[model samples]
Target: MGEFKPVDLFATRRDWDENPREAFRAYVGSIEFVQAGKRGKNGADTIRESSAAVYISMFERFMTWIETRNRSFTSVTQEEIKEFLDLRDENGKTRLTSKIRMVYVRLLERAYEHLNVDSNPAKNLAVGREEPFRRGKEKAKVILKVDDIQRLMESLPAAPAWNENSKNKRQRGWETRRNRALIAVLIGAGLKVSEAASLKLRSMKPKRVDGKIEIDLEIWDGTGTGMKHTAVIEQFAVPEIETWLRELGRMDLPSDLVFPGTIDTADELSKPTIYRLITKTLDLAGINTAHSGGRTLRNTYAAQQLASTNDIGKVGEKLGHRERRATEMYLDAAKKFAEDAV
Candidate 1:
């Protein structure tokens, strides 16, 4: 093995203050670690691309799995490890995907440094053997059109199942107002559904200064929630959004979630629930494709924002993009605009 470089895991604290975490993310992304020519290149190149949260989750699970054998990662034999990798099922016969196994490899690679192992066994095993699985490109890229957005907004209140008239008129009105506010903040703020769903009452602070109310949105950067990007983009909240904020404030439950979970917990809305809500809203409007939910609205928000901008840099900043290059993904073709105008 080449001379091993020590990893400064604790160095995150110092770096976190001096640089934006996104910059650190970009820096980490630029690094390419070396691994020997092995059975394939699959495992060697997989770790860095995995999201940090996913990598951590996989590590925890894999560590537990190895516990049964009473083996630390360094002491495990290559064949034993490979067998573990090849095993399709756990004790319950639950099949593991190849993507998951790669996470295991990544965890071991990091853990081995603490063990001071001279040679890495998993480094070359099945390298280049399999292609990484990814979320569908179609799902990731779907965006709603302006008419679809209008339809979605219009369909919010009267959408049958959730809006049956068994309750008092005021209760129904409150629910409709809350839903509208949720949708408006989501679209207006360009929040990920998770971020919007996990919001808290304390996060929205309003004060009267010079006879005018000034609102400052304080977002919780708690784990697995909103991105710093979304918060940056939606820096200034307008009057309509504030009206919803006012409604949210009246509940006066300090610990309650601003958007409320399924049972009123502060937990963010699950992706499945968010997907169902968006799909149902669109389906009610008679739109054919409703499978693409929060993501579609998010993309539409970006595209519309970009279409209205003459300044790429401003849009990039507002969108909380890593760089202007990332903002190009939402940019519409200029040639189409020219042709349409002519």
Candidate 2:
């Protein structure tokens, strides 16, 4: 094991003038020690420099809040924690999304445990599930319609232009094939952006189901922390993926990343790159990409599945959701659209 370098929490503190930086530093150091040498979900040591930096930033923010109120970390109450989160949301300092709130709560819980302080103030604080179609939110209808999806797919290049031999032309050719395959997998297989980005060539296998050939995609959920599951791509998408694979072979590119960025030799495409590709494709297809990006494809898949099968459970399964209610929003939206059509 490599020597664990201590994180400098004070260096990342943003509210140094209003808060006692030393207090946050000590609190974060104690938490770091408690988490040190622990095995993470990925079977590696829990303590990482990147994770430590993130933890310090979150803790520093919270401790700054406590200090501004002339309160110590050990003196905080459940009500105060809730108020802090509310302030964070209201001030637009942070969106206070469920995921962000959960991170904050986890930090508090773990910190309390490390401090041997009973009655974790952040315990039982509800961070609601993310809703796709929340009422009164103009952003609810983010999913692309089936026709829009078809048009978007159609706008993409069928194959690389064969005659363009320039360096830029060759790069564009590879990008087109890669991006098309990336979008096909996202929409057809209903994979999350992270899942699609992390897909490797080895994760895809050709299989025979009922004497019919199909491509089984091994998707790693929760950034590879969750269990690996296989999702068969729709027949419509197999051709594009196969073409992309052939292009990769022709270029003598590494087969490690199914969709490698132009400069990404690490066998992975970043999420932002995937988002930009989807947005650019949508724009080229004459569809509005505002407030809509990669997740729209996944949502479109879920909506189509629900509309066709009228089964929430099945839609949830197709979307790789562990909970049935995760599919409910799509069902609700589908029903509402149907009624509006009447």
Candidate 3:
């Protein structure tokens, strides 16, 4: 599908899935969103050019985060919506004021409403709405509880049956190990989804330091941050990462990619594939959550680091955040969880 030109932006000629990129083009084209923006709080019937650009910019930035993390609009949950704002606030030059952040929640809610999504995660997130969480008291699903995190680590999904597919039994073995390692690295390294997708074999090399498994995973948070940092995985996920490395080498895959799509192709895992893996892991751990994705693990990792150091600055560094302000929310969360325990 081609970019919908001026006149064609308003019509829904085909299903949104036919061309999601194209559909977003229609969304940002200013016709549909203009209608949405006109009705929200403090909204004017006629939008200024600069004002319209604000909504477009919001969509563009949000979509960038979504695509970077290998997620889609339909798959985004309240957890992701909050995480995007937090990331932008952390990485952007200017701070996102509470008022502006509220606007973000409203805009997302409106667009999702217009697009006919199953549920609007952004709904009632902002404080002005007339729901239970409207005053912002809703418990966010940002990180797994400490108990749940323990459960998740203990309940790694089992490998597929070797005898079920006799000819490809070995393939199943590596694939299972591959899946387990992916989850371990995610929890241990707290990697962004794209970073995980783009990971290479050499990135985790020098995997052992002084004969102990200390994977020095390097990550560059792409999308204009232009920063590189290392996450040291010492003991949390050592065994799984070790097992996966062995299986990955034995597969004889042509690609250097640590997590390739298949044995034959060098393609990175798709968004849905990563999403499903996270979901299945959570399910196996018997953790009930509305949003089950990598970001929760990312949050868990941040919290774990914070617990270890009791230092927001150090946690921010471990999380590869250049600005300490970006980690303020995590600090707040860590404090709140501590208080709950008390």
Candidate 4:
């Protein structure tokens, strides 16, 4: 292990007053102790990536909560901690279990050790009681509602007209097509961001069904199952996919990746690139309730499918989830949306 260099996390808080996300990532990643954690059967049996995701995700949600309400993290107290974790929707039986809330409090304690903040608000915090009749523990999904989805779709840049043949216009046209397709595949098909990036020309099978186009995604490792599954891109996003396919065909690139990568001639698009793309897209659509980049979009797909079908097994299969519990994570959001419509 390399020597852990301790920097004052908020020694210059103002540096990130205008860029909270970047600062949060920087401080979190810089802490080496937090990353190593413990492993094996003796030491909590936790994997680094999975463990990191838990704490990092919890902290990110806290930051987003602050940002969304136009509040700063300058003087966050125990009261703020309580308010954030105590969040509950209308029926009060949300999927956020006691374990999840406990992790939020714990991560804040570990994080504040490096922060320049006054005191550790989460040092002895409690997440309060879990609502009655809670199911098994899982991360609470930041699922977008119908209006949010509509706004996102409408916000996607339209295909540029053919008459604008200038160099800049042509460049913009290709980017617009690529970005639009990326968003459509994520929200429309519910593919993981990495899975969508790994897509090749062969993965996509477009069919004209009764005068409407639908895309079939032949995924081999979509859910880490090794088995293959064919997920479809819903009709609402067909036009954007079509436009991207045409533009990609024109490039005649050496790589067959559906999206542009670090180098089009070879490597597939990087995960970070896809993450940033989705983050920017979400910001443009005015969505700040979640942290992960394309997760909200993928969750939207799950919620919508659950709402429309009301079949847990079918939605799980479509998402390439091997277990029913994995798909059930979207149930609270799905059920809420369904009930709201009535």
Candidate 5:
């Protein structure tokens, strides 16, 4: 077979969900091929299809926003771009995230470059800075404390309740077991949500080191860059994982996916589904699920590890961060908490 190319990876045709200004639509369309096939200096395709789609979609939305204000691409100013960054719907919530803002800003910058405009208005506009205040109070980082994690764990049932009259009772039981195991890996191994979702059944193995048992979890970078690493699951989580595996064995499910969505499907659970699972678990634990999800668990794990070991390098390695500075935020937070306690 030829080199495998994912069917969903590229769009051969352009399909806009809404009609944009003719000029804006034409401009975006002119660069479609370049956007789809953009490569880095190493001649590797830098943009993924998903990112291409997002850029195109955001450009269209930006065009729509500008049209309402009677502005065209050439006539747009940096101030207008900043206003767009702050654009909110009728509910009074900002529509763009920092990531989305950066994408839109890049799109505008590229548009200016392509059009050979003398000056690029978006060049100096900063993205990703937090607003001075959300109403009045400072925005807090979303994290789960040790007590919150304990409550979340306690909220999980030991096993799904069996009802002879209920259809697919065994399947439900297996789902519960699998969910518990999934949360265990998220908390115990500090796996990212995408990493957890992409886990294969064979990715987990029990190993003993220095007379202590641990679960060896294989973590894929999830960026489609083909990078792989390993993280250790605490010994305390091993029993629940074993129970989940037993349940999977009983269901005769394939070993391809550790967290399959349905018995009929072999595909791994989508990231959104994994997110909802974490949120639902937090809700059940009586914790505020707002501004928190699976990442909160990862942060909690990082914070706990740093608090215990005070080793930044080890914590960074465990979290799969390429740089020590990425892990420093957690260490700083841990220190701040300590100082506050004192």
Candidate 6:
């Protein structure tokens, strides 16, 4: 008898797992989520990113509040939601804008569903709250010039030790080197902090073909807990990127994670550790993330790509956006670049 490959079994059972939700539920059940739900006072809420337990707890609280106040779910109308929004301003918490109101309204909609209401009062609620400020007023600020980026990187050769409690400097070591590389990659590659952390060792491979070596990035935005493929590239011209990959010895194993935590013992890097890397690197460079952040890197990538080519589609594709229209800001910058050059 020959050895059976895992792919053969998968091929054979391909039709067996047709219903994705059932398969997912089965997987979740296998992982004890279903059992945990059973143990709880009520079945899982499975709404508004709330767990069944949280839903039950909240529902219990809501019931108590309504009963004590002699109120009904029907009594809560759209006007009440509007009144709540009004109170948000009265309480000096004016940050509750239309987007936030929509979220609150969504929560109320879910509440109505759970309460078995005929209609969600929040449905007719208009998100007419004027943005606290105009889009012009909230324009993105350029935090780092090309020279500033260079100087900042030159300053932070390693992550500095900072005492969270005392707010003082400490010692630096290999961990410092690793953190520096992580930050450099985020800025150089314009990767999200989470994406940088989740980076696999194999995905950072530098391919050599016909005596030419080019670095590549294999991006993944996993879907439904299944590993998702986002972008693949043979682009980017940063020497430090290749140097860091070589230094880390992650040039071979595609399955291996790139920015792995020293203490994780897992395949991929921890998100918190990556966040700390960003903060520590910024602190060492004396850069404030208020302006220069992971998001800034993303925006920079979009802006630079757009300016260089004046093609929104190409930049959008590179940035993993499904729509070119989504890259309008980048396109707008590219247009400005064209005008400025002329």
**lDDT for each residue of candidate 4 in 14-77, tens digit (9 for 90 to 100):** 7456665555555554544345333322444223344444455666778888787787665577
> After superposition, which runs of candidate 6 have C-alpha atoms over 4 Å from their true positions?
1-121, 124-138, 141-143, 159-172, 207-237, 250-255, 267-273, 283-290, 332-342
Position 317, candidate 1: lDDT: 54
lDDT of 3 by residue, 181-245 (tens): 88888888777776788888877755565433433444432222323666666476777787677
Candidate 6 worst ten-residue window by lDDT: 1-10
Deviating ranges (above 4 Å) for candidate 1: 1-58, 65-72, 75-108, 112-140, 159-176, 205-240, 262-268, 332-342
Candidate 3's displacement at residue 91, Å, is: 28
lDDT by residue (59-145, candidate 1, tens digit) is 555555666787654466667666776676445542554555665665455444333457766655535323333232212445666
Candidate 4: lDDT of 259? 84
Q: Which stretches of model 5 miss by more than 4 angstroms? A: 1-97, 103-111, 127-140, 161-172, 210-228, 288-290, 336-342
lDDT of 3 at 273: 89
Between candidates 3 and 5, the one scoring higher on lDDT is 3
Per-residue alpha-carbon lDDT of candidate 6 for residues 54-133, written as tens digits (9 for 90 to 100): 33443344344445555554566666566665554453755344444544554455444433456667665533433442
| Per-residue alpha-carbon lDDT of candidate 2 for residues 95-146, written as tens digits (9 for 90 to 100) | 4544566567666776555445567676555333224212323335466665
TM of each candidate vs. truth: 0.56, 0.61, 0.55, 0.55, 0.62, 0.52
Provide the clashing-pair count of each candidate structure.
6, 0, 0, 0, 0, 5
Of candidates 2 and 1, the better by lDDT: 2
Instruction: Give the Å error, residue 80, model 1.
Output: 10
lDDT (C-alpha, whole model) for all candidates: 0.51, 0.62, 0.66, 0.67, 0.63, 0.48
- The alpha-carbon RMSD values of the candidates against the true structure, listed in the order shown, are 10.8, 8.3, 12.5, 11.8, 7.9, 13.2
Candidate with the larger lDDT of 4 and 5: 4
